[model samples]
Target: MAYDPNNIFAKILRGEVPSKKVHEDEHTLAFHDINPLTPSHILVIPKGPYVSFDDFSEKASDAEIAAFTRAIGKVARDHGLAGDGYRILANIGENAHQEVPHLHVHIFGGKRLGRMLPKE
Candidate 1:
């Protein structure tokens, strides 16, 4: 998909939109999700323009992805989600229901997060 520069996350990154900031560094930003699934749900994204994991992987540098994942871990640890085990999710493409095209990782925990997927 063609990257839309005006996507919400992009706006959030550019400070055009406000968000409950969680963790931010030179490479990534983490913020509270508007529609949280768990008690402590946060969204992490790279500072660069990336539409999806595929986009990120193909275009981003190793250092960029490293910073992004480290930002995720930091957000998890800072929010006290690391101790009890939290979930990190990245929804890709239309079938996965990725609303915003910008690449992002969802981190959530604090309650008993149920099964990850439906049992077949």
Candidate 2:
């Protein structure tokens, strides 16, 4: 899918929309989810206009990739979720129910998250 410049994440990055920002750097922006599923839920997004993980991995510069990866780790550690662990999830496509067109990762922690999916 094509990246939408008007996507909510893009708006957040552009400061057109307000977000409870957690971390901001030259390459990324991390913030608290407005409707969190876990006790500690944060969304980390790249500053660029990438539609999905595939898009990002294929097109982002090495510096951007490194910065984004480090940003995720930093956000997790800053939130104190590193010890007990956390789940990092990025829904890629329509089948995965990716709500937004921009690439973003969800950090779920602050509790035992249980299984990632239902039993078969």
Top TM-score model: 2
- Model 1 clash count equals 0
Give the C-alpha miss distance for residue 20 in model 1, angstroms. 0.9
Candidates' C-alpha lDDT: 0.92, 0.95
What pairs collide in candidate 1?
Answer: none
Kindly list the per-residue Cα lDDT of model 2 for residues 1-120, writing each as its tens digit: 788789899898888999999999999999999999999999999999999999899999999999999999999999999999999999999899999999999999999988989999
What's the TM-score of every candidate structure? 0.96, 0.98
RMSD vs true structure, all candidates = 0.9, 0.7
Clashing pairs in 2: none
Q: What's model 1's lDDT at 47?
A: 91
What does candidate 1's lDDT look like per residue over 1-120, in tens digits? Answer: 678899999999988999999888888999999999889999999999999998999999999989998998888999998899999999998899989989999998998888889899
